[model samples]
Target: MGRSFFRRDPATVARELLGCAMLHCCDGEWLGGWIVETEAYLAEGDPACHAARGRGRSNASMFEPAGTLYVYPIHAKHCVNLVTENAGVGSAVLIRAIEPVWGIDAMMQNRNVSDLRRVTSGPGMICSAMGIDRASDAMDVTRADDWLLTGGHQVADRVTQTPRIGVSRAADLRLRFFVDGNRFVSGLAREHTRPRRDVLGPDKDPSR
Candidate 1:
């Protein structure tokens, strides 16, 4: 996938990113996995977004061009996001979870865990497993040789949407997207059950 693939609404990119391979080359070795879960943060009216308070030193990357990496720290761990829309847009898609597929041994070693389910299962884990941190912020994956995002496998009916986790504001907004029945997804059981649209009624559209 190229920059154009991400030059759209953050919600669309988040939903369509499922099953895509995210690879990061480090020290001649590649580490990554299939994206299984993501959350979209809008540039406006999204109180949970980092750019909600206005762009600054820490969130400048979120305002960069599409395909930019906006890595941030939370609770001593890091999370990686892909900037979306045209330049100046603060919207981005957070890669919440991934299914380990490449460099499993390296990922496990980095995470200091032996269980496959624990590796790259969440946003913080994915950053640790892939050696991503503040240094990766603002890097354009669309043009970088070390970072690559390949075309994804369409999940279609298997895709589910739910309220984003770990956010107090806008908690009712169902902006999180994940592959149903995927063991790699990180969240409570209810989050993986069914799409929120089934219960939120047709009047509500969180994708906006």
Candidate 2:
């Protein structure tokens, strides 16, 4: 995908990224997988977003150009997001989960786990699996030779949208998207179920 692919609404990018692949080349070894789940964080009225309070030393990457890597530390681990829209806009798409496809051994080694299912199953695990950290923050994945996002698989019909999990504020807004029935998805069965359009439409204002 090009820079234009990420220069859009965070929710739209989150939904469309369900089947995309995020690959990172580290020390001549490739590590990555097909994206299985994601959550969109908007610049407007989303208090759960890191940039909701405006850019700071920790969240400065969130204010970078679209396609930039926004890595933030949380609970002693790190979560990665792709900055969306134009520069100075704080919106981003958080990659919640991925199905390991390439460099499984390296991913397992990075995560220090033997179970394949445990690898790259959540946001923090993804960062550990791919060796992503604060050092990668603000790097433009679109232009980087080491970091690449590719069209991995087609899963339009298999997509499911629901309210974002693990967020206290704006948790009812349907901003989370994932591939239905993909084992790599981190959310539980109830969490991944698509909500009724009339109840909370996919594009409903998250502030509500």
Candidate 3:
């Protein structure tokens, strides 16, 4: 992904990330996953955004340049974020779910799950499965030097948006986006943000 890909508003960027591949190099082995669900957090106005209060220890990455990773933990579990918009703008796209595509065996082993969907279906699941941590907090996602990667794929009318889950403030905002019908997408099926035109089936690996 280029810096321009994340230069837009967090909501638009979140929706656009559907079907994009997250390339990871872990333990000297290449691993990949396709993004299926995302949630937008805006610093300027969103109460749920970590930057709502201002730049601090937890949200420092959110104030960094575009294409940076803003990873943090929630409920003692991890969730990976893509820092977007301008520096100090404090906007990020929360990668809420993904469909495991490459290094399936390693992902399965890391997650301790034989089922593919369960391996990286949720934010915490994908973070743990991907080995993302503070060490990668500010990694440039556009890098190809065996670090992070964001690759595009076809995602037409399969996207559905809804309110972000597990947050009390700004809970009703329809900012969550997902590839409809993707089995790896977390959350209730009935709570889809909007009506679906067609459900994009299983995820396919996007080649570099």
Q: Give the top-scoring candidate (lDDT).
A: 1
Q: Rate the local accuracy (lDDT) of all candidates.
A: 0.86, 0.85, 0.81
lDDT of 2 by residue, 1-208 (tens): 8999999999999999987778898878878878889999999989999898988998998999999999988998999999999999899999998888778899999999999878998999999999998989989998888887877577898888888989999988999998877777886756545531111012211112
Candidate 1 per-residue lDDT, tens place, 56-120, comes to 99999998999999999998999999999999979999999888777889999999999988998
The TM-score between candidate 3 and the true structure equals: 0.90
Kindly indicate the candidate among 1 and 3 with the higher TM-score. 1
TM-score of 2: 0.90
lDDT of 3: 0.81
Give candidate 1's TM-score: 0.91
Error of 1 at 62 (Å): 0.7
RMSD of each: 7.6, 8.0, 2.8
Between candidates 2 and 3, name the one with more favorable lDDT: 2
Candidate 2 yields a Cα-based lDDT of 0.85
Per residue, candidate 3 scores C-alpha lDDT tens digits across 1-208 of 7889998899989998998788788898767677889999987768999989988987798998899999887787788899889988999999988777788899889888888778888889988788777788887877647665555568758788788989899999999998877777889867654542333443544444
lDDT of 3 at 136: 81
